[model samples]
Target: MASYGNDKEDYLKRLRRIEGQVRGLQKMIDDDKYCIDILTQVSAVTRALQSFSLGLLDEHLAGCVVDAAAKGGPEADAKVREASEAIARLVRS
Candidate 1:
């Protein structure tokens, strides 16, 4: 449930499409696709995943993080730390 409940279906569909793209990549490799062409597809998949992650992060910030901050206690601090860690991980990737 990392995704907002109402947005879950959209995320699922996006994931499924990315899954198909990955399978397509494998097939292309099996078929001896050009190296640059394969690399291009890989880039596309990476961008798609990053976009999806950012969307989920936005939702978390707008919902869970905001709510925790509003409460102004240990939970709020934890939420901020959690978000910072997540951003750091993404940046490293």
Candidate 2:
């Protein structure tokens, strides 16, 4: 099963909203809007994407990592390492 199968719909909903935001941003550019206004929308979109990423990461840790760790073996170690790497990448971003 997919790691975030349960949240798949919620994720898609958020992504669609973000997609709309992106389209709005494009429109703002085409209309020759103020720099600050366009930048404000850009920041909102960035933060929304970050929030979505954190939520998915949370689910991965809670569901996938926890289950793997419960199994107690090489799979558990790999999962922990994978989760740590994911966190590192998120932090860097």
Candidate 3:
């Protein structure tokens, strides 16, 4: 029932990739890798997650927000507010 349901598999694949990157980070730490190198990889992982979050947010706006807006009522307002809050959170992060 979620907006990302249609692309759930793709999302999962991305999450798995991110998970792998995290494991890689752990390995880098355990191996006592160079500080700069590890920091670079950490930046890469952060960017990946940010990109993923943005994609999901776009899908939510396109699917859920649009659908609710079309119906024109309190639900639509709530959806818009929910989406605004989500955006704010993303921005803060």
C-alpha local distance difference test of each model: 0.94, 0.95, 0.98
Colliding pairs, model 3: none
CA lDDT, candidate 2, residue 15:
99
Candidates by lDDT, descending order? 3, 2, 1
The model with the greatest TM-score is 3
For all predicted structures, in order, the TM-scores are 0.96, 0.93, 0.97
Q: Estimate the lDDT of model 2.
A: 0.95
TM-score of 2: 0.93
RMSD of 1: 1.1
Angstrom error at residue 50, model 3: 0.7
Q: Between prediction 2 and prediction 3, which has the larger lDDT?
A: 3
How far is 51's C-alpha from truth in model 1 (Å)? Answer: 0.3
TM-score attained by model 3 = 0.97
lDDT for model 1: 0.94
Q: In candidate 3, what are the lDDT values of residues 1-93, reduced to their tens digit? A: 899998999999999999999999999999999999999999999999999999999999999999999998999999999999999999999
lDDT of 2 by residue, 48-86 (tens): 999999999999999999999999899999999999999
Off by over 4 Å in 1: 1-3
RMSD, each candidate, Å?
A: 1.1, 1.0, 0.7
